[model samples]
Target: MSNLSATSTAQNSSTPIVLTIAGSDSGGGAGIQADIKAISATGGYACSVITVITAQNTLGVSAIFPIPLEHIEKQLDAVFSDLNVVAVKVGMLADCDIIKLVAAKIRQYRPAFLVVDPVMIATSGDLLLKAYSISTLKSELLPLADLITPNLPEAAELISSDVPTNKEGMEKMIGKLRKLKFNALLLKGGHLIDDENSNDLLILPNHVEQLNAIRINTLNTHGTGCTLSSAIASYLAQGNDLLRAVQLGKDYISQAIAHADELDVGQGHGPVNHFFVGHANVR
Candidate 1:
C-alpha cells in the first residue's frame, strides 16, 4: 500500500474522494464514464482506473479489449498512492485474472467503502464478463465488498437459478443473496419493470429494506446500474450509513431516468440525465 496522505489531491481535505475501477464506454453512457459522472453529480471527487475498453453505443457493444494486468495494477497503485479515496466502486472486470488482481489490491489498500457492481451482461444482451470469471467474482471479490449491487439477471447468475420477476420472488432472491456472506447487497430490481413499481432490495447483515419507485417508461435506460452503484459509493464516502446511502442513490437514479428524454443522444437505449438537477441541457 502506498502512502495516501503524501499524495492526496484534496483541495479541502474534507471533500470525499471516490474511485471507480471499471471499463471505459466509448459512448460515455456506462462503465467508468457513467461512474465518474455519477460520483461528480453526487458531490464526490471522481477518480478512475480503467479495466477494459469497449466499443459500444446505445445500440450495442461491438468489441471489448481488456487492459493488461500490469497496467491495471499500476492504475490501482497510482490512485491509492495519490488520492484520498474514501470509497471504491467497481464495475466490469473482464476476466478472473483481473478479478484476482483487484481483490488483492483492495485487501491491501482497505478503503472505507467498497461497492461492487456485478456487471455480467449489458442491457442490450451483450456479455461483459467472461463466463469462467463468475466463480472468482463470487468467492474472491465479493467478500471484500462493503456493498454489492446486482440486477435481476446478475442475482440469478450468482445463485445459479432463475431470478424471480415478481415482488415475492425478488424478496426470496434477496434472502438467497444474503447467504453468500457478503457484507451487504443492493439487489437492483430495475429489470423487473413489468409491474407498476420497480422496487430495489437492500440487504445488510442485520436487516432488509425495499426501495420502491414508480417505473419510468423510457428507452434510455443505459448505465443505470453503474450510476446507482457510483452514487451509493459517493454517499458512503460522504459518511452516510449504508441504508441511507442506498436511498439517496435510488433517488438520484429515479430523477436521472425521469429526465433522460431531455437529452437526445444515440438511437438505441440512451443514457440517463446524470446532471438533470442542475444542467438540464448541454447538447
Candidate 2:
C-alpha cells in the first residue's frame, strides 16, 4: 500500500472534486472518458485513475490491458493525496487483485461517497471482467460502495441467478438482491428490451423507489451505465441527498439518450451526447 498523505488545501476550493477509478476507453465513449465528461458536465471537478486500457470503440472491445498493481497504487496515492475527492465512482476492475487493492485504498482514504458500477460485459458482448474476479467484486468491493449500479445482467451475475425478462421477474429478484452487503442497489432495467419504458429500482434497506424514463429508441446508447453512475456521484458531491441525486442523474441520462442521435461518432452503438446543450439546468 502507498503511504501518501492527503493535503488539507483541497477543502478550500469552491468546486467539488470527484474521482473516477476505471478503465480507459480509447473510444472516448465509456469508462474513464465518459465518467470525466459526466462529472464535469454535472458541476464537479473530475480526476481519474485508470485501471485498464482497452482497445475499444463503439463497435466492440478488441483487447484489454490491466494496469500493474504498483502503478495502480501510485495512481490512487497521487489523486487522494492532492484532491479533496468528495465522491468516488469505481468501474472495471479486471481481476481479483485489482478489486482488493481498490477496496483497501477506499478504506484508507474514506471518500465521503462511493459509487460502484459493477461493469462486466460490454454493450458489444465483450467480457471486461475476468470470470474469477466476480467473487472478489461481490465480497471485497461492493460492500464498501455507498451505491452499486448494476444492470439486469450484472445483478443476475451478482446473485448467481438467471436474468429476469420482465417487470414481475425484476421485482421477484429484490429479495435475492437484498441479501448482498451493500448500502444501496440501483437495478437498471434498460436491458428489458420489450418494455416501452426504461425503469430502474433503487433498493435501500427500508425502501425501494422506482425511477422511470420513457425508453428512447436509439443505437447510441453506449456508456449509459458509466454516465449515469458518474452523474449521480457528481450530484452527491454537490451535497444533494441520495434520492435527489439519483433523480437528477436519471434525468441527465434520459436527456442524453434522447439527444444521442444528434452526434455522429461511430457506425454502431454510438455514444450519447454528453455535451448535449438541452439539459443546461441539470447541474
Q: Using TM-score as the measure, which candidate wins?
A: 2
Question: Could you give candidate 2's per-residue lDDT for residues 36-130 as a string of tens digits?
Answer: 99998888899999999999999999999999999999999999998888889999989999999999999999888889999998988898999
Local accuracy by lDDT, each model: 0.87, 0.90
Q: What TM-score, over all chains together, does every model reach?
A: 0.93, 0.95
Candidate 1: tens digits of C-alpha lDDT, residues 1-283: 1111222333335878999999999999999999999998888889999999999999999999999999999999999999888889999999999999999999998887789999999999998999889999999899888888999999998998797878788887866787796888888887776788878888877888889999998999999999999998887777676777788899899999999999999999999999986632210
- Quote the lDDT for 122 in model 1: 96
For model 2, the local distance difference test gives 0.90
Worst 10 residues of 1 by lDDT: 1-10
Global CA lDDT computed for model 1: 0.87
